[model samples]
Target: MRHQIASVDADHTSYLYEWKLNGRWNKLGATVNSDFVPMKPGSAEEFILEHYWAITGEAMLTRWNTRWSMCHGV
Candidate 1:
């Protein structure tokens, strides 16, 4: 299984959307907008990790968390 950063918004507010799947198109939940702050640094990694636990299905958390923690030390 793998994860992808689908989209991000940083104009006025910092918001991110991530799509997680195993060689297929599967949608995971999105992260809550972290309020609007101009000139703030954006982090795709932070966005994905923040919302990874809320992904759809039962085992998504286990699969994603295990992989993420292993590689990124989450």
Candidate 2:
């Protein structure tokens, strides 16, 4: 599986990045210009986590819980 990050920039431009992951993509989220900063080595997770919350209006923990429960039937 892969985790994909997609966003639209301030100029209405779009970008995407993909990373391998062990889980499926279901409760995937989207980010916008305000949600992200410059991406550098070793900062992918931090950037995604920050943008995830900014876009979802939920904490990372809560979003993960909800996604897990919904997808895993837990």
Candidate 3:
């Protein structure tokens, strides 16, 4: 994997329609593959993908936690 330091250029949300990955807007029913697969039992995907939360405005003090389902399949 290539690593570089730059400002975040994407947006993430609970709904797939509002998500932007890799600097491209994700439309409904669109899919993108990545090398970052969740490992057995506990892995990085769990902590990163399991929960949805947002914080914004005024020094980013306010945060909203959104509930969603976690899917595990191959």
**Residue-by-residue lDDT tens digits, candidate 1, 22-69:** 544443333334343332124444445347645444323222111111
lDDT of each: 0.35, 0.38, 0.33
* Candidate 3 TM-score, true structure as reference: 0.22
Per-residue accuracy of model 3 over 29-64 as CA lDDT, tens digit each: 222322233233344333344344332234132223
Go through the candidates in order and give the clash count of each.
0, 0, 0
lDDT of 2 by residue, 46-67 (tens): 4676766454333433222111
Measured against the true structure, the TM-scores of the candidates, in listed sequence, are 0.22, 0.21, 0.22
Cα deviation at 26, candidate 3, in Å, is 15
lDDT over C-alpha atoms for residue 13 of model 3:
35
Best by lDDT: 2
Off by over 4 Å in 3: 1-14, 17-59
